[model samples]
Target: MRSTTPRIDVVPAPTPAASLVFTTVLTHGPLTRIEISRRTALSSAAVTKAVRPLMAAGYLVEDADEEARPSLGRPATLVRVDGGRALFIGVKVTGDEIIAVLADLCCRIRVARHLPVTDRDPGAVLASISGLVQELLTEAEGFGVEVRGLGLAVSGDVDRAAGVVRYSPFLDWRDVPLVELASTVTGLPVTVDNDVRALTVAEQWFGAGAGISDFALVTVGAGIGCGLVVHGKVVSGAHGVAGEIGHLPIDPLGPPCHCGNTGCVEAIAGDAAIIRRVREATGAPVTDSAGALELAHQGDPGAREAYTRAGEAIGRAIGAVVNVLGPQRVIISGEGLAAYDLFAEQIRDAFTASAFGTAAQCDVMTRPLPFEEWARGAAATAIQSFIGIDTY
Candidate 1:
């Protein structure tokens, strides 16, 4: 009897140069062959070779730019990725909700969905993800394209190579084989990565970090997370845990962290920490981040103090990252940005106080990325895996 399992089709790039060429075009295209070569640092001949197969595969398309044509030369032709060539799904598993996006080969989000996750059990999360993927797959049918892959992004220690989520404190999960389980249920090639790192991939390719060689993405919300890009590559430490700025112990006498550390950045600055502090300080029935934020905005001294402290912790954490890596820029994002007004001044002051001489020159800016963007980041990871890029 014949087997009934669906077979996943791997995209054909065939060489590192091909992958480079494709990425260059995807990120900075409708470019002429010469522009692609210049951007990728590949020889014109190599760019031509790479483009040939991709265009033949319908993954790339070329168009004549009559207006861009030089009077003395052949009409300038531009090459770009064919976004409709393939489809992908990206899911971001947060502490309380699941954000999923249906995207194309170019990583453009076609649709987004959010499902509140009341249960954090591994089985429940997997089932939610599988259902989301099926919905996305059905949506893909309308585009007449196959859903090529699925990407899952979770907070915490993720071993992308091993396809396992080693530890996810937010989800109270440890040693979970997420990729295998998700792939088995969805029947599509799956890529699993740390949520922040996955977001970094999207930033590196298309967001504020684009065209920058070294940058850091720091997220503040339920958790304080950092994603580092050095020499134009996302740094996944040998142990699959890098840019863990949240766990950096800043105050010896500070509050205890779930990671078994005292005065950690997250302990002082995360949403839970802020809420706890607000409740203790105000003696109010502050049950959630929203209530705490409202209290602060309403001139509650205790709540304002809590935000100030969190801001100080976050600033110091960014300073530590700048001191250590000297990235050109640090992009602060995540859901916690909702309270940026409450802590902006404190964060700046603390960062200035902690950063050493030249490191203080690093630019720090905030960009509020919705959960959909994070899901799209997950999709970007799947696209990277499909194109044989080093997402890890």
Candidate 2:
């Protein structure tokens, strides 16, 4: 069911209609021509025209369903994306580690590798990344597939249009042209995006936000990050920083944030903030996130209180997003969910208490995603880039 490398067909670069038809099938197939027309708002003739080239290129296949007949005396066959046409690589870079996955055209993971970084310098991280990509390339050789693209996802201010990392606090990098560097090193087209935004894209295409016109994914952990999709597009803002609920001023008297702002949502709800509060309130020399979660689970009053406050802050931030955008859902995720039980009640309470009117009716759900899922998001970004559908 899984292979490190896959046999890739020589799929021609798709035209605009071809791209649309292929995406429609990949998301909502095996669909008939009539159904594809209804979903994409193209005429049946246009759908047929678009699908023909994709089918010839081996990117789409028609499944025979002779038993199923249309009213016009012709049997309608179902069309679906061919998952083996190409391969891509997606990598999520965290402060201390890199998680990379080799994925097929369908964005399914074929192989994954993780590397730890002892240094945050850009050169050191790039070297580690190159080694990992080379390993995956060898894996690709076994399948006789060419890896078409690479997606690199990192946190902090990212200028995705320019394929640059403007400022990555976790990586201690500034103005690094990541896409060009990675492309040169790996010999493939590359896309660089904000980690949370890349994750949102994956969610929009295949996860909880699928078919929804509007939604938000809020990540709580070392950093509190939000990714917003509205009116069927992820809002990257004019300066490439939108949906940054973490910097919203929620409490004037709250602790200072690394962004040099006092009382920001992230200042009150981020991991470091919670750990600092726990240490001060409990005098328990807790040094890291695991220790903080352990103390909270053990019923330590200070640890519990810290999480309670963080939950309140995060809830209010989500409330702000809902009040403004009115998304149909808000997905809560990230490594921080390991301690979700400690603060779940507080999050619910604060959200209900502060959300304005019908905004409270917006569904809020938490789905835990591991690091590999984030890497898959990176792969999704690469797919978007390859298809020339990248809006950001």
Candidate 3:
């Protein structure tokens, strides 16, 4: 039997200035009012006005900073988001499993659950999603705060504005009205987004990309995905697909992609592609990524060569991103980083060879983000939508 969906009480809409102040503090706090004013470019009076209502709502709190006492005036009172005031739920749907997290208003994951997805059908996925959400809602009851919103992140082309999954190759889904369906079942306002973009949002606010206005996150795993942040905003192309580095045709005669293209980056470097190449190269019954990785670690020349080629392909894609966008930094992430040791040299070599002269100077770094982080990213999107940010 299904549990009754909880009623959602919408938060009071904050003014533009108030929203800005709140986000600034949420990302970089506990800041003094003067510091918040300086960071947000709002005047002291404006910051005060913004802070007053948020504090009154119990969303923000002030703490006296005795150590920062000024000789001429009173000690500074630092303001920060009261994370315990509310809760949120975030879920990331992969082809084979679902990752869910219960997060505080600050987007901190208080609890996480993972469930294997045996069925790809929309109805089955929705049922699993609702079950996980109900579990989280029960968890939120312990904190005595409302679960304000739910966020869902999936891979492939997603129209966030329309709340639809236009095409998700992994799940073999198209035109699924995810937001409406999930919202109806979970009884909470929902935000739907591409998985990579959702992760970029979390990075922008709380991770490595924080404070960096221009950067790109390149995720290498089952698929090669790129998320771009330009001018302090995550750029969702006008047509809803941007930064698709995986589809770049680096080799015209290369392997065929699921997207019906030849020589696409993903066709050459994605996990399945790598596994196929490894099996063909070494004549090993390498059925999965782990098996292929094991062969490479065992010094199998063909398996090692496969990883090298994948690294080269990935590097070329990164070079393309750098030459075009000229971002200050490029963050290499995803589950594929487990094999970083096998292809680190090839990736660096190919990137240096393909990058334009000045573009070669772009800083490239790797960070391995767990599945839980991806779920947290989904939560961040919900927070963005709740705060009236341009999540779409």
TM-score of each: 0.97, 0.94, 0.97
lDDT of each: 0.92, 0.87, 0.91
Per-residue lDDT for 71 in model 2? Answer: 67
lDDT of model 2 at residue 208?
A: 97
- Candidate 1 lDDT by residue in tens digits, 282-305: 999999999999999999999999
Clashing pairs in 3: none
* Candidate 2 stretches greater than 4 Å from native: 1-16, 66-75
> Which stretches in model 3 have alpha-carbon errors above 4 Å?
1-13
For candidate 2, the 10 contiguous residues with the lowest summed lDDT are 1-10
Query: On TM-score, who's better, 1 or 2?
Result: 1
Stretch of 10 with least lDDT, candidate 3: 1-10
Which order, best to worst by TM-score?
1, 3, 2
- For model 3, how does the per-residue alpha-carbon lDDT over 315-372 read when each residue is reduced to its tens digit? 9999999999999999999999999999889999999999999999999999999989
Candidate 3 whole-model C-alpha lDDT, 0 to 1:
0.91
Candidate 1 off by > 4 Å: 1-8
